[model samples]
Target chain A: MLLVAPAALYVLVFQIVPVVYGLILSFTEYTPLQRGAPTFVGLQNYAALVGDADFRGALWVTARYTLQVLPVTIAIALVLALLANRSFRGVGIFRSALYVPHIVSLTAVSMIWLWMYSQNGLINDILGTFNLSPQHWLNEPSSALNGVSVMRIWKALGSNMVLLLAGLQTIPKNLYEAASIDGAGRWHLFRHVTLPGLRPMLIYVIATDIIYLSQSFAEIFVLTSGGPLRSTTTVNYLIYTEAFEYSNMGSASAMAFVLFAFIAALTLIALRGGRER
Target chain B: MDRNERHTVYPANRRTFLKTSTAVLGSSLLVSACGGPSGGGSGADGDLTVWWPGVNPTEQDFVTEVLIPAFTEKTGRGAQATFIDWPDMSTRLNAGFSSGTGPDVYGHGPAAVADLVQYGRVEPLDDNLDQLDESDRKDLQTGLESGLVDDVHYLYPIASTGRQVAYNAEHFTDAGLDPDTPPTTFVSLREAAEQLAVHKSGKLQRAGIVFSAEAVGMQQAFTSILWAHGGEMFSEDGTSVLFTSDEGVEALTWYASLYQGDAPVDDNLGGTWDGLPPAQSPLATGDTSMTFTDPATLKQIMDAAPELDLRFMDVLAFDEGDEPAAFGGAATGLMINPDSQMQDDAWEFLKLTGSKDYNSMYAQEVGIVPVRASAIDTDYVKASPAMASAVANSEAFRSNPNIPAWTKIRDTLAQYLEQALNGQGTPKEALDAAAAEIEPILAEGR
Candidate 1:
């Protein structure tokens, strides 16, 4: 009890208290200026949330992003891990190279992507070789989501691959050897052993990715700024715009709670479906 | 499988106990990081603390060399100034306000005053400012009226910014246009752009002009015209949305057409048209032949590319039939943190910054125009012709309506302008939608 007491207290103060405060704020006209008092309005903020087109649009975008980024990140990571897991010359160098962007600052990575995705930038300059007309990467709404998504995939894939690589190493080589003696092919070995072994780590990685991506603010802040008419506005960016920039902290806090609930629920549902054993 | 993960998990070879201990230490450090003053008393021993944000390296040097030494000599008080990043400054100020240990004075934007006043963090200078000269007081009145909350002043003017057309003299010479007389009106600017605009081997090198999503809300080169064209961005009480007028729609449409054929949106995009460096300032990149930019950026172009030749032009009106008006506002001001230890010293510093001596000093060192009209005619500005014209035009400068919800309205209008520029919505549709978003914010303010 003594050992767990400190860790539990930390969570209770930092994590749970903030979440509870946000929940209370969601039901009130919670101005930061009027710190002591807030006019409670029940679930009016949540009701108001439904009426906000920007919120709805953000929800739609986040939903689409989750579907697109999840499978792609996992697939690419697994493939890279397969190639990486085997002994090869200069494999260590390749391994570090894959993980470089993952360890890079989000601001730095976002700025580099902002430059790459900019018109007259790296992407356009490359496309010029194929006689492709330069597209307005971050500027236009039609292509804005895809532009942001591409950056997200590139940013996220490395970590997912690293996790899968770790999980791949955990699977016993003796199992593969026995399977091979039984005349099992690589696909059969992977299906029987690697799939089951990596399930728990895969569940953790996927849940974390959903939670982080749903609350994505850094890339959106740097690149599109929820713009080209807010084609890139995420729930987290909405919370920022509402709170800090506009000082509508009550509404911002309300939106934050809604987002927290959604992300938590999504993560739970996602993890629940994975291998619990 | 990983040595790095091993290092991360057990820095000193302890397991769960270690990780938990590190987390405990981290939070404890965060506490000490936030707690106040190690230096004993209320700084009554003649220490003046100031909060500043980053700019050019020269600015850091200016604070160290000029402002501090001069201020210390005048007051005989030791001034300690701390520089923070701009974004971090906001959070720091917020924390300071909440904690009651904020700096004596803060270098903040004018836009910050409205909210800061509301939070009761900033003190109104209406009474504290009565001691300054009438001319100085008048300038602060004209300049800081927009930063008022409940009809009381919260900020003193320190610098000014406006949208004036800056032209590349070389582009003008190369395109066979008059290098001295760049366009003053929209039509003339468009014609010049058509002539001067150049695209290269699948790359755009230069453009005639640039437009931004803030064109309608800010309209520095165009705001006065936005007002005169029978379109006001806000109501008189500072409580209602007003820019959905037919005139406002017409204004946006007119601005949009400038980019449609004569200029590509790509040409006018951020940094591309500013002639900035790798980040792409539209003017700096030579993407735009002319730009409606702040004169402050002129120094940037000179430093960035010494060979680059850019000229300044005033904004033209809505039409040849109408009078032209330029948008104008001061950059930021110094304010009294209500929670500051030394109220008398804070007031003294504020007065000194606005005094002719320090005004001229700020102008010379910072290259910003003084708030007072009389300060505009100084011999210093006369030495430079561009400075002379801008100083003279400072009289015609007007501020945004002192509205409570103006910030949110600005965001709404920005999104609307981008929509109108992209043809996603008609100018009318965009204006109506933006007005709709602002209506509630104004209503809530009421």
Candidate 2:
């Protein structure tokens, strides 16, 4: 009761209710503002979704972003964790320094990164030293998504590094010693003992990445706002645009459901693939 | 880890219960001590709440120098002003209106007013509106009648604003074009733009115009071209969309031709529909030569870049087709919530803010053009070198069709127009698609 009841109540009050209400709204021509009221028609919004070119485009962008950010953030975090796991003189200090960003606010991180990505910002300032011309890092439609992905990668690294640290610590030293006695090389030792030990943690990390990537709103909201053009319009951002800005709550909910199905399918496939590996 | 070792039962359980009951008794006693009112009930009923969203410093100056003092002197009602961004305002307002609370009087865009009125959230100003002096009120331009929903005025059109071509005079002369004579025809406008444009290296240095037709801003821009070519968004009866007409197609073609590839129809992807990452745009840096702007936005630009050296031109006349029409909208005005508790007091504060002296003061501080023709500074309009032509041409401005669902239609039009500009669809296809989507929405209200 203690474990499930509190979370269940919380989900019921905020998440489940809103999702149910939103799903119910998907078939109706529900615009809260202007003239007219909601009138439900079964499968209408779904039919519209099926035909929407913009929705397809958004799905493509979301898949591309998730693929780009997920592996990159994971690889970088693993590298950081490996480096900080060593017993150097300032190893403890380095570990804390690596963990600092995990505790820092997202708004602060996004703001700092936004400044860093600006034309006259840190990256541009460095490029200028080599006599290269400054580029609008977050301005061009092509680079805006990449720029946001880089910031997310930086943010994702901290938390993943912490998880990796826990995974690294749990791997028995006796296993490494046994591998060493068997004349296993450093690569073989790591492959045999460390990799297998970290598999569970890897699965947990991958699941987290799936959930986080699907709901990547803040960085997009603070950064390019799906812009230069609709080049960066993710499914969630697209849903928000339809609901709040256009007042097409009905269509927005339909879009939301479509996004949910997509992410859910991808997550299931990912978990199955991880298990197979 | 043993159960016996883990016993750390709290001693404060009984004490906490006793203290909580005592605190409740103490709180009741405290309430009794404070005596007969809803504990610190709003400092005074004399204080009024007004909502406006614009340049904060300018709004602050207006409140400090004009509205507050004038209201206090006339009726002794102190005003509490709140600022909200125009885009996020609808959400906040809807939330507030749903709950019967906050702010006695507020201001919003004319179209937003229509939506709010439908919800029965705002109070009708017919009583005080009728009380406005007949002669003084007549001077309020008829274009302000756009605030009317169902033939009943839901908003007070406090000030007038319109779009005009803002250009750098220094560049105009250097480009071998006469500063006095701006473009009057579509061909000449293109020629002028070509002359004014400056590029260096691979980077685009300066452009003649930004083709993006934002909702409030560039509405005049793209629409003016359409108007000059004998196209409009709606028919006179407000029943049909006229965007796909031959004139509109020609206008779209002309606009798209300026850019070699991927014209900047809307850098934010129709602004509201798709939010963009926060970064400095070329327009923000004054990288464009001639751009359309309303007076208040122009004033804001000048404030942001005081070194801005620019000239203003009104909407141009067509060669032989249609009359010129600039886009216009209101700044802000006092609106009472019908659901407000203090109805009579709110009305009194509204009257104070709307008084000729107080209102005019409000206008000057906020950099708004006077809505009432009587208040258009006779000396300033005649002599102010910069604003004289604008003042003269202000009379020719027109409002976009006041259909309530026009926001959706307008955004949809922008998207299709963007597609047409990029050669994805013909101008006619774009317009026809928009009309097909919008026709039902317009018919819904009727």
Candidate 3:
């Protein structure tokens, strides 16, 4: 009990307490600027959310952003992981290069990507060289979310790749050997042996990825600022603007709990599917 | 011990562990909930704590090296100043105020004054204003007026700001326009822009003019135009939306028209050049002939390209012979915390910031408009034509309504304005939608 005290206290203070406080706050009308205890308004904040077009739009954007980025990130990371898992010349350098984006600060990475997506930025310059029209990558509604997604996928690739690479190493050589002895081709061995072996780590990666990706704010903040028509306004982005910018902590907290519930449900669904498989 | 013995021992121990842990957690929770220093305590030894917004290096150096030291020397009271970036100011202030550890004096834009007043977070400065002589008060009237919420002063204005048309004289000359005579009206400005704009292969290579189109910027640009057309954002009491007036539609139409016609003046629809380095600005890069920008950006462009014939126009109106107006006022100013134990010291600090010597020096160093109207006589304003123009037209500057919900209202309006600019809806439709949405926020704020 004493050994577990510090970790338990840390969680209780930092995580559990805040979560409970936030849950309580969601049912009240509060602003940090206002004095006195929060006024209990029951579900008024949540009810207001039901009528808020912006909040509903934000929900769609969040889900779309998650769905758009997750599979692409996972697939690309898996491919990179497979290549890095092999013993080759300068493999460490290759792995390090792939992992650099993960280590760089998200804000810093977003800044660089912000420039790259500008009208006269590197991306447009490349297009210009090929005699193609320059694109307003972050300015247009159609491409703004996608533009942020590209940066997010790039940033997430390194960490996901490292996790999957570790998973790749844990797959016993005997499984591949046994499959090979049975006249199974490389594709068959990957589908049956390698995939099943990687399942647990993949499940862990997907669940966590969904959680983080759904709460994406920094990239959206730096790159688009939930524009050009709020195409990139995620739920977290909305929550932040609500709490800080508008000073409507109750509404913001309600939005946060709704987002938390969503992430929980999505994570559960992913975990259950992975377990079933 | 055998496996069976170990299991039995572990279960018994676990029960004891759980009970003790629960008790410990409960105590900790109770202790934490009840503990911590109460809000509204004076700083250690009564030293003033100040949170000044903006992390500009020059401003930081001036405050820390010159201002604070001078204050201590004058009054024998020490002050600690912390510089915060503009975007992070509200978040930090919110956290600080909630914890009751907020500074004795903090600086923010006038737009935030109402919200602070609404929550009784700020000290009213009406009493402090009496300390200034008649002449000093008169000199500071424009900025002082901006700091008022419900006709009561709250913020001690430090800097004044105005948005005006900053043009490249070289571009005007090259486009066969008179360099000395810049457009005095928006209509003529558009006409000048048509001649100045350069296009190749259906792509705009050079924008004749560019207004700021990024988030908050769009609202400012639109408000400038709206006011120029004699439209108001809200009624005098700030309870009604009036930007949906016919004048507002005309203003929005004119703003939207900049990017609408076959010969569009602006190329980058939603791009931001406001906070870019001087070298990267569209004016410096020759990407635009004229830009609607703040004094700081205009001055930076001049300094970055000394050889270029850069000039700024006074605030422009929609039509000739109409009153010219721009969205501007107290850019930033200091407010005292009501909970501060050092209100007198805080007020003294604010007075120092508003004084001619400090205000002029701050304006000169930071490249912002001084709060005093008399600052026009200062050598810095005389030396910089951009500053002179801002100071000359200080009377024409307007700002968002001083309401607690102004920021929210501004953002809400900005969204619809963006939609109108993008051709998603007519100006009338957008403004009506914005007004409808903003009505409740205004009512709630009231």
DockQ of every candidate: 0.13, 0.12, 0.43
Candidate 3: regions farther than 4 A off: B1-45
What's the residue-level lDDT of B388 in candidate 2? 49
Model 2 TM-score? 0.79
- Model 3, position A152, has a per-residue lDDT of 95
Ranking by lDDT: 3, 1, 2
Q: Identify the candidate with maximal DockQ.
A: 3
Model 3: lDDT of residue A45:
96
Best-to-worst order by TM-score is 3, 1, 2
Per-prediction fnat values? 0.12, 0.06, 0.43
Candidate structures ordered by DockQ, highest first: 3, 1, 2
Tens-place lDDT digits, model 3, residues B1-446: 88888778678678876786567666654443332333353664677888999999999999998899989988799888899999999998887877777899999998898999998889999987987789989888878888899999998899988899999998888889998988988889889999999988887888889877777889999888888988888899988999999989999998898888677778777777543468767888788899999887789889998888889998999897678999887899899988888878888999998899998999888888888889999999999999899999998998677998788988999999999998888999999999999999999988
Interface RMSD of 1: 7.6
Chain B global fold similarity (TM-score) for predicted model 2 against the true chain B: 0.76
Task: Give candidate 3's error at residue A265 in angstroms.
Answer: 1.7
Candidate 2 regions exceeding 4 Å error are A1-16, A23-43, A87-141, B1-51, B54-82, B102-104, B123-127, B184-186, B201-203, B211-220, B261-286, B318-322, B341-351, B354-356, B363-393
- The true-versus-predicted C-alpha distance at residue B342 of model 1, in Å, is 2.7
Q: Which candidate is the best by TM-score?
A: 3
Each candidate structure's count of clashing pairs: 20, 7, 0
lDDT of 2 by residue, A153-192 (tens): 8878888998998999899999999999999998997788
